[model samples]
Target: MDVTQFFKAPSGPASMKRKMAAEPSDAALKRLRNDEDNDNDEFNGDEDDDRFMHGDGLTEAHRNLLDIVDSAEEAPATIDLPTLKRYVLKLEKSITRNEEMRVRYPDDPLKFIDSEADLDEDLHNLMGVSAAPELYPNLVSLGTVSSLMALLEHPNADIAIATIQVLSELTDEDVVAEASEEGEEGMKALVADLMGHQILDVLVQSFSRLDEFKDGTDDKQGVFNILSVVENLISVDPTIAEKVVSSTTLLTWLLSRIGMKQFDSNRQYASELLAILLQTSRENRLKLANLGGITSLLKAISIYRKRDPKEADEVEMMENFFDALCLALAEPEVKTTFLEEEGVELMIIVLRERKLSRMRALKVLTHSMTGEGGAACSNRFIDALGLKTLFPIFMHKGLKAYKKAYKSHSDSEEDEHVLSILASLFKTSTPENRLRLCIKFSENEFEKVERLLELHEQYQARVHAADMQFERDRIAREEAGGYDGDEEVDAADMRYLNRLDKGLFTLQLVDLVAGYLCTQASEDLVREHMAFLLNRKGKDFDLFIKVLEEYAENTGDATSETNSERALILTVVEKLQIISSS
Candidate 1:
């Protein structure tokens, strides 16, 4: 997409192109003349104009077929399959008629699919034999799943492959959803049957292009479309994962696909699908682990770890893959071995996406840390400064303070959910690691440090209690001759000791100095933080004075109280000093 061009706001008024693009779907021209296809092939149009949709152009056949499909849909699943088939046959002729549409309206089909109604259509049903079984019962029959599977090899490879790819979407989702809803083992078996027969070579062939081919855009696009079908199919029918493990050849092929560079367009989506496939491998998960699949996924994340980091497609793809991997790793089953595999720094990355990815990362981390995975995690956490690395993430909200955080809370029913998770982790987790997590998240980054301290205190009691339990267990275990190694710490049990020792001192100072960094942020972030810090009636003058002295030294160009911020600091300093001196 022309990202900038599409995102650009209306000029003094709307432009002709903008007006045409935004016209109501009912009014928009779904069909356009195709100049490219000598046979006047009409491509399906998707209304994906960026304002509403991603705005990739579709063609005539896709458009007309969709219109026919839409015109046929009832409230939900009530499509008249027999009539629909007849309509589709006619729709094919319409596409043949509009073969010339591609020339004049190369992008019209993309626009049509972007329309709300068209976009909302159940895509799986569109391609599945069940949706139109009366017309092609044999192709879509329960027994015919294998028959449909055969199309994957028909002489016209494109038609056959596309049909099978679409079939993957159709049956699997219904079967899987059915299984989940009613505990139907039969549904699972049915899904296994259809997918088990998959043409393994075709699946790999779909990904083999890898964007290296020099000619034939049509063929290349067909491959891309097939890949898209694969994405939808795997997403809906993850249970079909059994098929992945059936053949040693298929398993190795997918593993190799997962190991491929994420930057390869043809392979990128497939790599992500492979991750999903791994997660769905109910009994085969252990096999996946032994094959280094988790490491392969981490390597996928590494591919996205940019050095200079311009915000681009790679960044976006990396973000998507990052979330998928974390989500996969976080699942109860997957988390078992994932945490033990040198993933602490990777966990920190999840907890620190610097955007919404942070929450997603945290969700997965919390899941892993709360289950059996937590045992392995706690043992490994302190070795890597585990929770310490994520502490800053809990404390961040740009240069702005809890004002933004609070604003967010007001709008979202979701709390600053991380606090509770950390508290829970602190209570259930080993005391040493809990304390380190406290010291870590408690740093003062951009705005205020007090929030960090407050979160620290909220968890302190639970952490202390947990630490006590951990200490007693340690002592008893030790007396029993259970000492694991010299690496273990002596309890030096001071039950009263805060353990606000040397390492945490840096953490506390980071919390305090992080307030100053807020001023360095863009003014909006600074103003937001100021609004939060200045909300209370009380003050801390000595701390404010110290902050002012440091700000003056760091800024060199400071004119002091003439700046509103400095004046506010001086005001806070006077009040705090009085409160302190008293």
Candidate 2:
């Protein structure tokens, strides 16, 4: 498969010639035509012009069959199994007959043009299968998919586009997902069958033949259908998804297609496919990252950093770029390359200068600083002067600033994410980096630590309110016969399972920072704000303590000696204990 098929456009006459050459052999066409003749003698005329030929000079039998299929395409109606299969066979026969006619009448443009119209109608009939997916298995067994796929390489662009539409309808994600929910074999089986027949290679061949920039309607719709088919396939199975993203031509095409300045449905879909592929597997993510996918993605997103996409479709395209980038950064290889390419600088610029993309940049940055890549990203983040840029936003005061900026309350997910990144920095900090971060906070008279404590208190209050609400709701439910005999226990289990619902991770993050400050800055500096970390909802303090104890216990098994992060957490636990005692 030429991975770069998307880079080139389909040729006009030359492409048609190739399809003409690839048509079924003379014997197969003769057999199919004979079968059609036997089945539809009434439509077979006597004279050369009268016999199976239209005003456009198409075969009389072929023209009549097309009329039947055309009416069936009027609405989302299902043709019975026997009739649908026969129609499929008839369509294949028509395509085969057309190929034979093209070969026999190489000089007869009228013959080939009418044949192409018949092929288009037959493809439309097959697309009606989208409304009746239960018949998909029968269609597959009848070898309809393989035949349609072959038409993708058809000489006529309209015929190929029509074939693409049929395939897209057959493998649409929603159609397949709905089928899967009902335990029916849908896209999964269809894609597996397609993969068996080397559908990807055919797609790439068709892709290289068409140019998006200069293509006519048929060619453009062809591009859309090809991407749609691939998207549907990938969304169905992991193995097939891997096979696709792992393709060098496909990866390159997707990257190039999305970078085009003209935003359209196909470009938007290409962006979406890239994102889904990356999100599906680490291998896909790594594959694209290695292919300079990140650079392509950032360039696309950077276009919208300062300026908002005016059209809704353009906005969706920009969103796909952001989503794809976030998933891409999850790969360690991509993260290292991202840092190497000054991606952090771009994100900083977005946050600092671009209002529309500010929080999106924050999200990308947060995802970048997580998992195995977190330490590397954190180190690079500091080196890129990320701290100088991030801390100011983190320390911004007042509701107006909050609403205008991140629009997150003091302990909203956005704020929690900012704290999460801080925790990651401290968790992965070298002593040198640790001291630098501490000095950053101290430079502003430790206002950063004070704010962390203030945020912790705010979250603690919310946790308290949540606990009260849960208790009240629980009591009300118990008195109102809301519980089944086993329901009370089930409710308790749910509460236990969601122990972190009270923003425990964010609270721990605050303590993680406070613990770091205590080790580097004056203990009194942390002590002044230590009370801010105390639980506001009476016995809820025990829950906070339990979270810290669990962290210490988990760390004790992972390491023989206490790391600074663990030690700092223990220090925070000790301080909280002191506050509880007092």
Candidate 3:
């Protein structure tokens, strides 16, 4: 039997499926019968006599089947300590034999191919150890982790790929979830050992060696599996994200891979891993910025600026890139890099073009233009004629048209992001740019203020419904032998969280933008228009003050920046109160 056939790698998204041992083939059965006949000719010749003496019982084949079943029944259901140690030893031996064979026959595939096959089978068999992650420390102590990492540099790409598959399985999140507290400690130890062996460097180096396009499906699966391994490690130990970026070229490889125009599982996986890494580690974000990650990501996503992705995976890849960009923009320096790379301009074009990327571009813009770091991005956005593109969406006319044209458009999400961008503009713009923003609301017959009021009412109604539900639930809980002190505090916390989820957060943003315009609009025309609209709804500046005060209180005192922003909101509240009294 050809052992290599059993080791064929699976294609598409990286997943772990253990390869079951194959049944014996007809040819192997014939050979086994011939050997038995030659070794025991007396028994073969006396087959009839033997059957009669055995009381018409089993033939040799039946007896063999019975023996197999008996052994299977006696086999342990799960791999235990002794079995794991033996498996590790077998894996190490396979690795050593394959290495030796390759060294002895550097130019001869026939000489080393069997060893390579054996090694592949061994690697896959090791995946069974993942089911028993509580034994990971045992597996590590057996010293096969280092051996597996070494195989990443094996001469044959298939061997390296198989090794990655094994590693991915061992470090998978499912294993993490299944592990007990002791098993978790074992997993941590195993991860530390893998890292100590420079798994990140080895994995990145394997990327250069395995050419997915040139080497066919197995090589492609290899790249995907390598990504899975790294992602799994990070999931197990979030600090690994920083370690990966700082210690290896994995981040650089991810940036390059995602930039490739060819859309494939690996590219999609690369985008996802990049987003995960960026979201997890501030140091990784800075590393990405210094490596021109912002520009690379923009260029990668710019393809969808005009044309939407044709496949669901391609669309997911686009969203991942946008998510990574937004996370990266959270870093102050990355925002600068984004502006320098014409990111603001790209987003404006995406918004105007009204492609599938429009909503994500809006979200990216909101991130780029937020906080003190966003001052430059916000100013640049206005300079790039962003207002012309944004105000149309903010007004909902363009958004309505977009939703009609595209089935997937999200009105509330788009509205939330657009309002967030406006709020950021109000917060971060300079005196000159601030006036430019306030002027937009004043123009168009106070149309922007009208829209703000419309959104305020919409979100306020949603929040009000949620608040009513909260009250009912609280009263019910109180009537049914209510919570003790801790439970009461938890219930209160849940109430606020429930409110936030049911549009309270968006409502706060709407009120914030409205309050900013009321106090700081370039002309009194915008403020009066807002006041008129508020009175029309039986609301006034006092209502705005009340919401803004609640919003400010929730801003917390965790950071000085939070305190400062809280103070700024309170100041806006004070100004609104004064105007309301007058």
lDDT of each: 0.44, 0.69, 0.83
Query: Mind giving the per-residue lDDT tens digits that candidate 3 earns over 1-582?
Result: 333344565554443333333344476467667766764655554775766787744456656655545644644579899888878888888888977887898776778778877887777778878778889988888888878877777766677788888888888888889789988888898999999998888888888887788633477777888888899999889998888889889988988888799888788899999999988688999899898888899899889989989988888999999999999988898888887889999899888888999999999998888765888888898888899889988877655667777888877788789888988888888888889888888786787788887788899899899999989988998899988999989988898899888888888899999888888745688888878877887878988888889998889784566477898789899999899999
Candidate 3 lDDT (Cα, whole model)? Answer: 0.83
Give lDDT: candidate 2, residue 573: 73
- Model 2 poorest ten-residue lDDT run: 14-23
Show model 2 residue runs off by greater than 4 Å: 1-76, 180-183, 397-411, 443-446, 472-505, 519-523, 529-547, 550-582
**TM-score per model over all chains:** 0.45, 0.77, 0.86
Q: List model 1 lDDT by residue over 1-582, tens digit each.
A: 321122112221100111111122442333333333523353334423342365334446556655655654532344464544543444343333333443455566443222212211222234533333233332334244564455445333333434443555444444345443332343344444555666444555554532334342223344444544444445545644565455534445555665766354445545555556655555555565667766766776654333312344444555555555555554455666676566656656544444434444455455555544565555465566555554554555452653453333221111233443443454345656544544443245432245644533343444456566767876887798865444353343233233332122222233233332233223344334433554462433243346445433333246554554344334444544454465
Ten-residue stretch with the least lDDT total in model 1: 13-22
TM for candidate 2 is 0.77
Model 3, stretches more than 4 Å misplaced?
Answer: 1-76, 96-112, 215-217, 558-562
Candidates 2 and 3 compared: the better one by TM-score is 3
lDDT by residue (tens digit), candidate 2, 1-582: 221222223344311111211234466456558866775664534654564354554556556555545554554444577767777887988889889988988776665666666766666666656656667667778888778777777766657766776777777777765664432565556777888888887886788876666634456666877887787777777577778756537878889899888777778888987887777688888878788888888899888667777777777778789898898887788888888888888988887763566667888888888766778778878887888778877876343664665443333666777777787787676777766777776566667766866776776676667677788888888788788868878987666445457765566666566555554444555544444444343333344566676666555344657365567567767866665566
- Candidate 3 displacement at residue 503 in angstroms: 0.7
